[model samples]
Target: MKWFKKYHLELLLVLPMTFYILGFTLLPLIRTIILGFQNRYTGKFSLSTYQALFARPDFLKSISNTFVIALLSLSIQIVIAFIIALVLKQRFHGRSIIRAIVLMPMGIPTIVSGIIALYVFGTSGYFNELLFKLHLITKPINWLTGNFKGLLIIALADMWKVLPTLVLLLLAGLDSISQDIYEAAELDGANSWQSFRFITLPLLKPTITMAVLLRAVDVFRIFELPQVLVGKSVPFVSTFAYEEYDIGDLNGSGAASTILLLMILVFAILWLKFVDRGGSFGNDS
Candidate 1:
């Protein structure tokens, strides 16, 4: 009774969050895992659902497409976000206005962004129209036709929507860095490139890893942009699972969902290991 009384306020603060996680996150994850291993009809243990899922050619394609989109989008986002963050870190006239403009896309709805992408890239879209007006092309260029082209467009569209969030994260990381270090490097006659390569990049490693991990996980589950832009013509793991669910293949959907969850888990583990090894190497150096 005395112990409870002493920690009562802390218990009150934590209990609700603990319960929420159990009720919402943990319960759902346990249920999904169970469903993945169970037969949909008899509710008996079986591997048939997983077998069927892997036998489908589209499922394999979806897995590949997921990786392609993730890599492309994340590559574009990180590079652009880093550059933008660096620029935004510097003080200039109307800097606040530029930052607000840069972050505006983060506030837009995903569906809305998808639609905007379609308008710009579709058959009668603004891009082809502009090219035609410029006499650059006599016919409308189908930008989202081939697998590479379609996937590239989807990746770019996703980047546009999510880039602002990454920029904010990197900007925060940059802000945490001390200006004194930069001034000291300048005084020691280190050039901009040398200072950035040695000081900024190394110090920013943890933040970069965090931003990449979060974005990679999110990108792996991409659905809406591809769904809106090209439908199931370009499949992602999330979309594949949704398609199974839509078609009443509950067990297959569960299997796909399980695979996706495992993929994310493995990727996260590998990333953490790589980061740990890199940290050790730095220490040794």
Candidate 2:
């Protein structure tokens, strides 16, 4: 009784969050897993839904497409964000304005970003119109057609939408680094490249890992951009799940979602293991 009284205030603070997780996140996940393993028609335990899901060619293609698009988008975003973060770390004229401009995309909704991409890259869009006016081509090229081209456009669009957030995260990580360390490196006659390679990158590994993992999960579950830009033409795992749900195949949708959840877990685990093997988080020393 005395111990309970002592901890009651702390428990009160935690209870709401605990209940919220169980009620919303855990319960929904449990329900999805159960549905994934059950026969839709009979409501009996079965693996037919997963088997059917795997048997579909488009489903397999979507799995590949999801990975490809994620790789492309993350590669572009990380490189650009890192460069921008590095530049922003230094003092310069109009730096605040530039940072604001960099962060502007985060305020735009995903659907709006998709629509903007469509306007810029569609058959009669600005890109094609500009090329035609410049006599670079006699006709407007359809940028959002063909499997690879369409996926590439979607990746670029995703990058534009998410890169600002990544830059912010990297900038926060960079800020946490000490100026004293850079000065020490200079005292050791280490050049800028050497300091960045040895000191900056190693210290920033944990932040980079976190940013990539979060973005990778989102990329694997990509739906809105592809759905808005090309619909069924550019199928992804999220879109596949949505199509199943739309067609009233709740069991199939559950199975696909379960697979996607597992994919995310496995990727996250593998990435953490890789990072752990390379170095400890935040501090290599």
Estimate, for each residue in 176-246, the C-alpha lDDT of model 2 and write its tens digit: 99999999999999999999999999988888988998899999888899999988987898999999999
lDDT of 1 at 139: 91
Please state the error at residue 142 of candidate 1 in Å. Answer: 1.8
Deviation (Å) of 178 in candidate 1 = 1.6
| Cα error, candidate 1, residue 164 (Å) | 1.8
Question: What's the TM-score of every candidate structure?
Answer: 0.91, 0.92
Separately for all candidates shown, the number of backbone clashes (residues 3 or more apart, or on different chains) is 0, 0
Ten-residue stretch with the least lDDT total in model 2: 275-284
Please tell me which predicted candidate would have the highest lDDT against the true structure: 2
lDDT of each: 0.88, 0.91
RMSD of 1: 3.0
